[model samples]
Structure formats: structure tokens, C-alpha cells
Target: MSISFLAKHPVPCSLFLLGILVLGHGAYIQAKAYLAQFLIAQAWQQTLDDQQVHKPWQWADTYPVAKLSFVTKQESIGFKHQVESVYVLAGASGRTLAFGPGLVLSGAKIGEVGNTVIAGHRDTHFANLAAVNKGDLLQVEASNGEILLYQVVNTQIAHQSDTQFMAPSDDNRLTLITCYPFNQLSGGAEQRYIVEALYVNKPSAI
Candidate 1:
């Protein structure tokens, strides 16, 4: 190969070389981490747009957008909703970006009248969540350009089998759940990091 060609393809060649080296040592995990960052970034924007546009409350009903914060080093990534599901897991089924990402939680579907629960992976995807804390500002932008702000109220670590994290509530609340320990390497963990957000108020239509 020409020197110029080698120079131009350095990154791709280095990535290929690195891939071969780390193929067995959490290669998929590392790759997924990089992909998850991009995927979540895009999903965040789209979800916010759609939420503001349709305002799910107008037609079928949906939850507000989710936002990332570093207010607490123990909180998880945040999102909003009206109700909770059973348990959320990460997989390959939602929107596809590069090489088919997967169905990561697309914000909690607005429930009738309760807290909306959303979940994701902690170590890779929600690593930044560890900095989220009470009183931290969360700005969820809807599809229709509406901005929903939330305030972090609490943080906790629930058991792996704990379903109370997804429980219903009397107030318009938001819950973010992820694997506990922040940086688990054995895949599954014994606990989950939960961030509780209280609805502060909606910002002006954006």
C-alpha cells in the first residue's frame, strides 16, 4: 500500500488491529459502549422532538423526554413517564443506527396516572449517571418542542429482583434505573442504581 493510502486508512487499520487484540476481552462490550453513546445521543434528540410534537398526551399518550446530568455521582440517567412497566432490559430491537444497535429504553410509555419507569445499562451506557444527584436540573425536550424540567430528589440501589423501582406513584415522577456498582465487569450485577426525579415544571415551548 502507498504511504499516503496507509496514512489515510490509519484509524480504520488501527481499529481493525485493536479489534483483533481485544476480540475476546469484552470486545463486544467495548464496541457496544461506543455504539450506545451514539445511539443514546440520537435517541435522546429524537425522543425529545417527538414528545414535544405529539405530546403523546394529545393522542395515544406518552412520557416526557429523558436527559443526562452529572449532579450526583450516584444517580442514573433520567427519563419521565406516567406509569411503570415490569422491568426494562437492554437488547437489539428498538431503533437501528450502525450495524443494528438495539432496543434500549425509548423513554417510558406514559401510563394512566403514576410514575413512569425507564431503564438502561450502567457501566457503559449510563456511566455518566454516577454524577447525578438531588436537585440537579433535568431538561426533557418533547417532540413538539416542549421542554419538561425535573429535579432529582433521591438515589438508591435496589436489588436485582426488586420491582419496587418500577412502582406507581401519586405524583408525576421519573425514575432511571441501571446496573449497580457503576462499573460491573461480570455482565450482571446484584443490584441496580436508581435515580428518583420529581416533576419540577415544564419550560416554555421550544
Candidate 2:
């Protein structure tokens, strides 16, 4: 009956279909984000197994470089039912960031003696970052099976043009960046939420 009605009212049916797609766009993007991470984790595991970079998909321009563990806990890999961690992909470009947080190429290399910057979408992966407070421990697992630990030192809100927050540092540090005002529903935010953590010399139970 619905198909017959659509056949008789093609224009109206088309409009209704488009409206449904428009309304579901947000959910589609979110579902894609999580699904992409599952594929990305597979690639990351392969990267670690083979000691080489692997793209999550054949057309993906970026590859996962490190696994970021936000909440300190014993979480097994393999995309668990409740995952608190994310795989950080290479390059902070829009296309790369859509799937997961991206590592800024201008920043220092991972696990190096300099600042490493990572950025993500506020509505998705980085939303939980707002809950991250100073003194919280974050763990980054590099592709080489080395775990780099960091202790959050500061959390600040800054204008988007403030490049100083992502600037290279002599001291080993990790900078997590996302659009400011996490509650904002629109895009083109002029501010950024910054989370800076200093690399811990010793590793914790994370």
C-alpha cells in the first residue's frame, strides 16, 4: 500500500524520504563513526602485528597510529560492548577526523620528547573530554607496543587561532584538542577546548 501510494504521489513521497534522511543524518554520522572505529581497531591490531601502518579501509587516507585510553581500566581490545578508549589516526584533516581523533602532523612524534597534539570532533569522540579533569591519567599506546603515560596538567578554553596551545614543547607533553562549548549544536566554533598533559616518566597500572 505504501509503495502504491508512493507511485501515485511520487513528488510527495520523494520529499518525505528526503526529510527522513535529513532528520536521521546525525544518527547516521554517529553510527558511521563507531563502525569506522571498529574497522580502525582491526587495522591497528594488524599494524602492531606486522609493524607497519594499515588503513582501516581500502580508500582511507589515514591509518591508526596509537590507541588512546581515557579511563584507566583493564579493557580488552576487540571492540568491547563498552569501550572507553579510541584509536588515534594519523593526520588531523577533516576526512580523517570524521572516523576518529587525529594526530596533528605538525606536533612531535608519538612517545617522543615533545608535545603531541590530537584533535577530535566535540559531538562525537571528544565529548567525554569535557569530563576529563586535571590530574587524570591518560594512556597512549604507540604502534610499537610501548605505552606512554601522561598526567593531565591543565584544561583551558582558548580561541581557535591560539596556536600556542598546539606549539611544540621541549618537555614531553600530550595535548588533546576539541571544539569549545561542547554543548553547541552548530559547527564553525571560534573557540577550542584544550587538555594538556605532561608525560609521566613512570607507567601506572593503566
Candidate 3:
């Protein structure tokens, strides 16, 4: 098109350009997220199979730490049904959370006797948590092939200043933490949504 034509059709041309930009931006975001998930899944597989840290890429800063699974039950009969799982990385840094949940190294190991805290972005890996409730069962599969079971005991919302959630406990526990008000789009949320689970039993190896 000539400069004169574009100038004469400024409004239509501008609208068309804006539509293209919007579509391009949306596609880019989706593609980036899909690629991240794929790499994270590959690293998780290697970690589980080799029982060692596995980075998604040559120079990646994070590695898979554990695999977490939640069983979805039927609402009518209350029978166990589908199960969904996700790989957890080592650090809770922004870079790590972009791919999956992160394990707090200072906390207890997956099968140990202390509070094991896992943090994830509310809108990503932890999004399904909103459907979780008390009594739900969670299976934490360690890199060593030991599967530890946990029963959700409670769910609460606490201020960001509350350190009780992170405190050490005598009994085995698993805590899932995410920013409160899951629907919020802003950063630095002052509250957190906590899901606490108690150790149940460790079944036979997989």
C-alpha cells in the first residue's frame, strides 16, 4: 500500500495493526509457557529415573527435586478417580516457579519428619489447589522412588508475617504455600493460602 492510502485509512490501518499485535503477544506468551513446561517435564523424568538432580538445559539454574500427585475423587460417589501430578524444582526463585513448584531446601525432605514446604505460583502449577479441601490425599514421590502419602488436615489463610506456617514440627508434615486471593493479578500479596497435610503411610515402591 502507498503512504497516501495508509494515511487516508488511518483508523482502519491502526485497528488492523493493533489486532495483529494482540494476537502475536498472546501466542508468544502461550508458546513460552508450553516450552517451559516441556523442559521441566523432561528434567523431572531424568531426576526420577536417575535419582539425581537433572537440569532442563545445559546452563539452567534449577533442577527437579520431587514429584507431587493429587488424586481427584468423584463428587457423587466419593470414589477415587483421576490423578494429576507435577514435578517440583529445587529453588522457589522466580525463574524456578516459572516452570514448576519449588521445594524449600531448609525444610524437611519429602519423606522426612518435619515440615516440608513447597511453593508455587498461584496461577500456574498451584492453580488446581483451589479445588483441594480437607481430607484430600496427596502422594509425594521422592526421587529415590519412595512414595509418601499425606492426608490434608487443614487449609487456612494467614498474613505474610505469620512464621508459624514455616516453623518446624515434630511430626511429618507437608505444606503447600501460594499467594492468597488466587484471583488477584498484583504482586506482593500480603496474605498466603496454606494447605497442611499430615503423614499417613508409605506404600510399597512403585
All candidates: TM-score: 0.53, 0.82, 0.88
Candidate No. with top TM-score: 3
Q: Per-residue lDDT of 42-93 in model 2, one digit per residue for the tens?
A: 9999989988989999999999999998853233422212237888999999
- Report the Cα lDDT for candidate 1: 0.53
Model 2 gets an lDDT of: 0.86
User: Ten residues in a row with the worst lDDT in model 1?
Assistant: 82-91
Model 2's TM-score against the true structure: 0.82
State the C-alpha lDDT per candidate: 0.53, 0.86, 0.84
Return the top candidate by lDDT: 2
- Candidate 1 wrongly placed segments (more than 4 Å): 1-113, 202-206
Candidate 3 collision pairs: none
Total colliding residue pairs, candidate 3: 0
